[model samples]
Target: MARLELENLTKHYGGQATVRGVTLDIPDGEFLVLLGPSGCGKTTTLRMIAGFIEPSGGSVRLGGQDITHRPPWRRNTGMVFQSYALFPHMTVAQNVAFGLEMRKIGRAEREARALEALRMVRLDGLADRLPRQMSGGQQQRVALARALAIRPDVLLLDEPLSNLDAKLREEVRIEIRQLQQQLGLTAIMVTHDQEEALTVADRLVVMAEGEIRQIGSQQDLYERPADRFVAGFVGRSTVITGQVREPGLFESAGGLRLRCQGATAPGAASLVLRPEAIHLDPPPDEHNRLEGEVTFASYLGPVLELHLRLSAEDRITVHLPNRGGAGLIRAGDRVSIGWPQDTGIVFAGTA
Candidate 1:
């Protein structure tokens, strides 16, 4: 295992910047995830770390050694691509041993290491099978085992679960997380899926437009976002553009007055409300309340997602537990929703 560091890492294409001054420290044995939408530079950053793409400026360090200009083969890093990237003609064992062969290891020791790596991913029984004969999930494991066979100092995954079906993706992700932990591997993954990042990462870095937005744990990003962008991206939220008249008073753009809690100075600001924090038919003592008609209701097993329109321009989303019969709500139904004053997160600026 190794600690990885990127200092003022930057990349430019022509005159446009792809990654701008990204600096981070990932301790040994940590599972760090880079999360953002498409064209957000997450993959570019990962490729830089893997030495597949050279940066325009800055440096990459592994275990305190500078490797900014090292070739991919000499970096001692394992990479699992989005597509399994397996050789169709090679059997599982041969594929896993390819890295060892590249390093000029003897045949007998290469075979032993290949077998052990396959065993780690629970694919030893299928060593002789070609990737064509295995399912997508199994093929993914083969790729993982191949990377592990070389005993790399760091593991890098680039949207490694994007090709699998929903159920299989969940299963394979759990297995990957478990295997990484068991080996104490330092891993970095780049992905756009919020749930996947939340599931496997010790810390998450959210980026946009070649710049980082926030770096925090799953709980911190969800409960206390640094800005409206983080709040809207890390999870579901209802963002209201409004102005703070005072410390605890706010007025919405649609002419609705509300009592809210925040230390934001009186100015143009926004209120972020989590779907799960709002309540239906709230008690009279609740500090924040709204009357709206249900615009839509979606039943999603354990919870129901509701879209409520308080006015022509002001709408909000709420999630309620799906208890049977009377608790069920539908579209076009009038309802009163409220939450505690402290439940809303207030941030300066309307955008």
Candidate 2:
């Protein structure tokens, strides 16, 4: 496995910086994901690592060696693109063996390695089939196999599953994660899908406007976001604009008093309340309680998403599980909403 590092990586185009002074160390065999919205320079960073885009400044290192000046083929980094990039006329086995042929491997050995890679992706029996003969998911696996057949020092995937159907995407994601873990390969994936990054990445680097916003595990990012941007970006959150009443308390314009953890003195800030963290019922003396009306409700199979009108201009969404109880409420019902004193996260600024 190869450890990848980018030090002070900066890329500029037409006098504008795309990647600005980004530095990160991806440990050997770790599944790291670069996650952000489109045009956030994630793909550009990956291209730099693959030697497709030369950095205007800084260096790229692989396995403790400087590879910033190396060519794509010389860097020994295998890339699986979003489009799969398979040769239309080549069979699965032939596609997998293409890289080896370029490296001048003997026919007999190349075929054996190709078969091994095909079997690793569970495509051994389909080796004779052309790309058009296979399903989207199968063809993607062949693409992965082709990349692996080259025995790269590091594997890079650029949203490899984005082309598959929803159900197939889920299945293939799990398959890809398992394959990476089993092979102990150093893999870096670039994706904009938050759920996909959370589901598959060992660690994630969140970016915006070509800059690294934050880097952490999924739980860390979800539970303790660093800023308002991150709090609103990673998951569903109701940004409660309020004035800090004290160290742990804030009072909103809607007359709701929110008690949060890790809050400071009286000031302007936003409280991030997750749907699952808010409760419909609160006992007397509970600190974080509010009054609202159920404006709308949708009966999802697992949970009902309730849109509560807290005030003239503010609406909060709450997710309630479908279970045996008073059942789902209607639009006109007045309700009291509460969250645990420490459940909601307080951000020091507005969205």
Candidate 3:
């Protein structure tokens, strides 16, 4: 395990920068995720760290050692791609032992290590089977085991679970997290899936257009996003356009008054409220309430996601835990939705 750092890293393509200056520090044995939409430069940054791509500027360091110019094989970094890049002709044990074999490890030692790696992924009994003989989830486990067998200093995963079915993805995510923690390996993963990043990473770096928007714990990003992009990108958020009505109050374009508990640097701003924070009820003379009509509703098993359209303003979606409010709300229902002034966050409006 090693501490990784990216200092003022940048990459350019055809005269336009794809990865603008990015700087981050990942502590030893930490699980860090680079999350964003496609073409956000997350995978590019990972490739730079792996020496698959050279950066236009800045440096990459491992355990305080400069490794910006090292080749992928020389960097001692293990990588698992989205496609489980296993050898179809080889059995699981042979696939895992390939790396050790390349390093000229003794045959007996390589076999022993390969078995250990297979056991770590709970696939010891399947070592004799070829990759085609296994399911998608099983092939994924084999890919992971192969990466671990090399015992690299840092583990890099590029959307490792994107190919699996939903149930298998969840199961494999838990397994991967457990194995990383147990081995105390430093790991970095890149994914566009918000749930995967939130569930697997100790910290997340949200990026857009090659620039980092914010980096923090999952709870921190969800509860206190630095800006509108982070708020919308990290999870479901309702944006209310408003100017600072006063130090702690805001008036929406639709004439809805909201009290934002989270303070912002003084300026024209907007308030972003999480769906779970807003309460829906009949009209009440409350300090912060907005009346709206439910325009659409969908039951999401655990939660009912309702789209509420405020008079003359943008529609917002609110998620209600279906278990509690399953029979309470419906489409076209008149409702008052609002959060305490202090429950929402005020962010600077982009010019």
Task: Give the winner by TM-score.
Answer: 1
Instruction: Select the stronger candidate by lDDT from 1 and 2.
Output: 1
Error of 3 at 144 (Å): 0.5
* lDDT string, candidate 1, 1-351, tens digits: 899999999999999999999999999999999999999999999999999999999999999999999998899999999999999999999999999999999999999999999999899999999999999999999999999889888999999999999999999899889999999999999999999999999999999999889999999899888888889999999998889998888888887788888745999988889999999989999998789999999988788999999987788999998776644578989999999989989888867
Cand. 2 Cα-lDDT:
0.89
Top lDDT prediction, candidate number: 1
The local lDDT score (0 to 100) that residue 266 gets in candidate 2 is 77
**Model 2, range 1-351, lDDT digits (tens) per residue?**
799999999999999999998899999999999999999999999999999999999999999999999999888888998999999989889999999999999999999999999999988999899999888899899999999999888999999989988999899889889989999999999999889998899999998888999999998889878777777889988887887888987777666666777888678888888898887788877777778889897787788888999887567999886785645598889989877788888877554
Clashing pairs in 2: none
- What's the distance in Å from true for residue 168, model 1? 0.6
Quantify all predictions' global Cα lDDT against the true fold: 0.92, 0.89, 0.88
RMSD for each of the candidates: 1.1, 1.5, 1.9
* Ten contiguous residues with the weakest lDDT in model 2: 319-328
Candidate 2 stretches greater than 4 Å from native: 324-327
Question: RMSD of candidate 2 to the true fold?
Answer: 1.5
Ranking, lDDT, top scorer first: 1, 2, 3
How do the residues 88-201 of candidate 3 rate in per-residue lDDT, one tens digit apiece?
A: 999999999998998889999999999999999999999999999999999999999999998988999999999999999999999999999999999999999999999999
